[model samples]
Target chain A: MNSRVVISNIVRWVLLFFVQVFLLRNIGFYNLSAPFIYVLFVLALPFGIPNLLLYILAFGTGIVMDAFYDTLGVHATACAVLAFVRISFISVTVNRDGFDEPEPSLSGMGFKWFVLYSLLCIFFHHLVVFFLEAFRLNEIGYTLVRCLLSCIFTLFLVLLAQFIFYKRKSR
Target chain B: MRNLWIFLNRYNAFFFLIIFFVAGIILTVRNNAYQRSVTLNSTNGLVGAAYEHLNVVKRYLNLGMVNDSLAKENALLKTEILALRSIDSAKDVTVKDTLRNVQYTYLPAKVIKNSFTLRNNIITINKGRLDGIEPDMAVISPQQGVIGLVRDVSDHLATIRSLLHKDTRISVAIKKNNALGSLIWGDRNFDIRKAFVTDIPNHVKMSVGDTIVTSGAGEFPIGVPVGRVRKTNVSTGDNFLAAEITLFNDFSNLQYVYVIKNKYAAEQKALELNSKNDE
Candidate 1:
């Protein structure tokens, strides 16, 4: 990867961490729901990034968030699972679009596909995080409702950012 | 080897995911209170919670002079209260309140770490051998209510098997009739501080609000408040009564507790052991 791309990625990482811990941490519906738009950084990586590197990056992001939130390992575990899913997701869906080199973003992938991918990734991450934190068989229903609201909120924020940042692409 | 490497490469991501996923899981679950109560005797936390609590302990240690003075004052007040209670008991003709000798001495200790969520919850107290605390010593709340007993000891720390532990069975008796039973934390919910007193004969009448007290069993002293009875029923197998009691001290917010060391415990234990050996 070029120095420019690496610098941008690093910048995105720090920016997302700061935003997640500071701005978005408290912005939730009631006390239970919050958007984790920092997931955008993971979702925006190049489609061809190494699987091993992705896991490491996800773990690092999660650890930083865990430190800030004091949730310890919750975010890191969720991010690692998300990174694992993203690998297969990109390979099967985005790579088939005939682009020589692809970035996993709204402009790079078509609108419908990007929406579906973001929804799936955010839903999976939120569901894992909420259920893992609850960890009780009786609280499964409560955790499901919490996971669903947080997933939709996070996906909405991620898509909004994509629309604002990315320029119009040829159909 | 070349073919093996190629085949391995084909499934490398899945295998790697399994490894990293396990690592990630350990990171998350290990720090959580639910996992700590099951695995450790409040012995461990992730590196961060450990360090964060180390600072808290350091601050608590610095309050030594104040705590010492307060404890001394409390001991004096307790002796006065015990004398006053004896005088009051003489006035009541029907009530039979027992008086205890000063055989068990109390040592003040702060709970450095605690968990109430798991089946076998353990509490780490700041007192150990150096502080005259030993395994099997009864732990009581500030109000002289039963909490649990010391299980394991290190040089400067001890783990108390809280009343919430599944295996804990402190011998107790109903306040109304000195009928014997043992207190067991049979409930799955830790949030509700409750326990069951089992093995009392079906003939012993028990009500919902009856007080239960320690029967001066193997380790615990007599008359320490166990809990108040909540419900009663008989299991199908036996004709004995099972009385659920709501514990007095909230285990969730426990901070400081008194460890009671029995002066005559060694002699009592030896006599009991000799009897068993003879039998």
Candidate 2:
């Protein structure tokens, strides 16, 4: 809620957006998988931000991302869903009694919590995004394989970002 | 009223979820014809401009490799120019096909984005509607082979469906026997650069090294180099021959290409379609 935290979060949002659009868009693994690392923005938000505020931020980020990727509302929808469901995972996994971390980054949430959180978050994100992109019931087999591969790819990038950039240890 | 306000505030995120899903469904389900908010289609200048600036920097990194390919293409064109000049100089005495009416014109473009590994690969070129490029225009690499077809056009950018795409089935023919067939990309590994010329009768005396070229009657002009037969096998039905051809154009190394606008394509297509309708 402080000005400095808000400013830094804004900076992180912009940085993640540009990196996803610029660097990651071109980095394809056999054209089958492109990492959706921008979701790290949603994953890294202050854990206590108002649910409505977080959802709006995630949805806005998704829309802008969809604009760049030319997928329309696809990213927004997935991001919105991710934001809404994010709290459910946190309550169950995080050691809430002892830890009072504001952000849910790998540094803040302990390694295990962050890993599971990112895998689940990216899994659903890619699942919705790719399946929506294909939008065919008959091609469910192809769509599922694409979703699984992309989920793994996006999860790897999101996890990598935490280790590389989240230099300070919260614990 | 107090209870209603509290519930609304408590479930605000859930409220937006429904809104976002509805908006998403509308955007995804509508085809371009029904789409009014079509800027989300990478054809928008906002997205195009960003990619353009990025490609400018990336294109610089590949300068050496691109220069080599440009030189090779230039040498090939120079020899062709010399051949054309000779024919022009001898035109008064010799009747030639070069004297035939010009049917197509070439527009130069650079490939800003090309994905070689995608099963249905799409390519982005730095020319678009503003540059007189349109969907269905034939795209070919500088060295003379099919690249793809212009699929969509923004103001200054266009996307091409690469020949490497699984859906591509271009009309091609064997050079020696002139047996017509269609060319396709990999059946097993979609990333494979080779193409297969399918539907030529089994009796056609084809062998390894037999050249395949665009039949010239369809999307491509006649006789542009396609590929040479690298391997042949009986197509699954056992009646037709299918040859694996090593493509002349390297999709991975592609940089510049020529987009061909056939002046008579519209008229010819109308005539052909009209005849088909009669049948």
Query: Pick by lDDT: which candidate is best?
Result: 1
- Candidate 2 lDDT, A1-171, residue by residue in tens: 588779988899889878888988998767677688889888888766777688788888988987898877788878877876686687677665655776887776578878888888888888888777775467898778778888888888777778888865543
Give the per-residue lDDT digits (tens) of candidate 2, residues B1-279: 999999987667668778877776666556323234543553586778998899999989999787767755764574455345434343354555555445566677878998888678899998889988878888888886799788999999999998978787789989998999898885775655688888888778888999899897876777778888998884657678788888888898888878877767888899999999999
> At residue B187, what lDDT does model 2 achieve?
70
Candidate 2 residue spans exceeding 4 A from truth: A94-99, B1-12, B30-279
In order, the B-chain TM-scores come to 0.67, 0.66
RMSD in order of candidates? 17.6, 21.7
Residue B105 CA displacement from its true place in model 1, Å: 52
Instruction: Kindly give the stretch of ten consecutive residues in candidate 2 chain B with the minimal lDDT sum.
Output: B31-40
lDDT per residue as tens, model 1, A2-101 = 7777897889888877878889987878756878988899988776677788888887888888788777788888888788777767767754456655
- DockQ for every model comes to 0.32, 0.24
If you assessed candidate 1 against the hidden native complex, which CAPRI class would it receive? acceptable
Q: TM-score for candidate 2, please give it.
A: 0.44
lDDT of 1 by residue, B56-111 (tens): 99878878777767776775675556445535433555654435434667777889
- Output the lDDT of residue A12, model 2: 91
